[model samples]
Target: MFKSFNIRKKIYYLSDTIKRKNVSNHLKEINFILNNPESNKSKIIQKSNLNNILNHATNTTPFYKKFRNFDSILDFPVIKKLVIQDNFNEFQSYPHKDKNNFKVSTSGSTGVPFFLFQDEVKRNRNKADVLHFLKRSNYEVGHRLFYLGVRLNQKFSLKSLIQNVSLIDISKLTDKAIEDFLEKVAKDKNSNKILLGHVSAFETILKYLDRKNKDITNIKLNSIITNSEHLSVETKTKLENYFNTPALSRYSSEEAGIIAHQTIDSPDTFVVNHASYYIEVLNLNNNTPVKPGEIGRIVLTDLFNYAMPLIRYDTGDIAKTKVCDNGSIQFESVEGRKMDLVYDTQGNVLSSYVFNKIIYKHYKKIKQYQFIQQDKKEYEIKLNLQEDKFPFEKELISEVKEDFGKDANVNITYVNEIPPLASGKRRKVINNYNKNNSLINPALSKHESIT
Candidate 1:
């Protein structure tokens, strides 16, 4: 099966480049220092490694050359996704040999599809983040389940074949095929593995569970891990109700494996990977640190990636910080996305989190729902729910009206299934309202919001 094949492929990839110094060695070296944090040697190791990364990025990468006069960390300008996308090759340590590197393109779900080169060190750090997150979530690396996504490598190639356990292509979100795939996962015995994918893909599955009135509590699962897309509390509660498992939200990107993750012990707040990367929650007006517990934009400086350094890079999402009494950082909550917001003509901004909370509170029979803002103050609600309770659609409509206010136009539509975006993350709320003026302030980019 693919489990073994993936292992074999990794072995082969390593064998082919053994003389070039495998990524595993670097990981082991860094992990040793991270694990033994109490040792004085930790500081020595970290400073030495970071200095080397900075010098390498400055000397080899074209973009960094312009920053030769960079004085302090604050003096370095924020790197936007667009800037990186346009000059990806120039950002590389070996720009001319970009194709020779392991080039990987993102799913482009959030409207940015671009390629990134992953060197051995970056790859190992990425893997470490994933493994560390899985450990925190009470799951292992090789848990059994149908992994969903488009196969990147060739179909017959050993790499491609190994990546193909339960691969489902989801370029289109609204599809019967996607529903069928979910049904299989729900029924398959071999899938005690946690259901994992973008928020959109899992939303589709959750909708199916709601519509059929299926007892997801009966389904076997270790935990439900949501990534790529925002994990709204509404979706989290619905997923937990059906699957009878704790739903953990993970914040990650293709460029970085695990930025923040919810541990099995602490399902609420996401702990930053402080050892791997330095995370800062900055004010939108200035890159100053936000007051404790205040909402701000999430910026990152990846301490690991040397081929391309990201100093104070904007991640395009908003988050609030909550430092525990013990001084550990955790997120109080992450708004669905900075761009995903709805507003009314009167200028009252409705948060996706608010919609999700209201719906979950009022309608228990409702399975999965999506809120679409067609215009200021106009909206449509879509649902996929149980058969016997299908008649309860009217009640749900009334509930939305009650929560959104009486004047808000609300329409209820029934669909067999709901699909996710190309990135496989399901968008719970789609705002078509003009960006310039809305009941709420327009969503600011991570960097834009934070200065």
Candidate 2:
């Protein structure tokens, strides 16, 4: 029932896909040049192309031109959520087209759910990257499986009908749908195929699968391709151990199709997609280039996207840069969203994912809690209790101290409720640390105040 698109449509889809795949391969060569000091001529070509593209966009697009005078990428001025939200039209390099292409909005997990348009070139690049990463894990493209969040809405949309004929719904990850999903996964032969979805949804599904004593590891499936969320080492291990397939992490965003990716040579690290775009790891505060092995914010310049030029755009992700022995740029880790890092009293930089585990471990007595760190030695843990749970609180403090340190002075404040943000996501932690400095604030203390 599920067949490929008709000849004309399939041709349309494939041509763009080929362009993007070609772009991705080109990027690899460019990255090879950038990583090697001896490939000086390649660097010159890349730099020249970048400058020309930036100049063209600046002269042609009103909003994009503002960054031209900026001496350093850091000086380009950060694009806050409000700026992008309000000035989307100015961000577009090409004139808005009719609905010949696709448009989707960001989920706004970071308080910015703005709509972005994707032409065939952008869409195909994305698909190619996913397919390429999957192939690395020995997965073939013809494998049968269910895909989450890939929809072509138009009712009785041609694409929808095609999916209905071929794809089975194991159910989406929701309170109402999860039980059915587990049952379907267990019974369906397609479960032995690749299960592709967002990392968070996949993780939640794995938990339920593990609890039911269903040995998914026995399933003859390829590896999992997880994107659009922070995939931690712990999460990766849990998924691989449970599913018995490698979990390949993909680094991408809407602005740029495929910025970086993991492959056989660098499984733990995301190599920059040097063919289609250029990547820079610079100090978030000052925008200066960070040395290898140093953590910094990620900035990218899309070389091929003349539609909406993203040149030296601050992507709001914190990561460490590494140069492999083979001389390639490796994105060691994506440390949550750029503004999402939490600091402890001892100035330890902790990712929110790290704390999520601690919270889930103590999920029994804790109704809800918000973590706020004011200074190097002070922290406030505000929580809503199902019962008094005072004993658990003391134990939590002790555990946190052990996990963090004795130097950390933590306060457990019991509250009625911890409010969800406007975007409908629960922001369980907030750190009012200095954005100007890459380091955590040593002077932060409890009295620093909470709004």
Winning candidate number (lDDT): 1
What is the lDDT for 441 in model 2?
23
Pick by TM-score: which candidate is best?
1
lDDT of 2 by residue, 365-421 (tens): 565667776665666788887576557767778777776678788888988876544
Lowest lDDT sum, 10 consecutive residues, model 1, at 442-451
Candidate 2: global Cα-lDDT? Answer: 0.61
lDDT of each: 0.65, 0.61
Clashes of each: 12, 8
- List candidate 1 segments past 4 Å from native: 1-50, 95-99, 150-192, 215-219, 342-351, 361-419, 431-434, 437-451
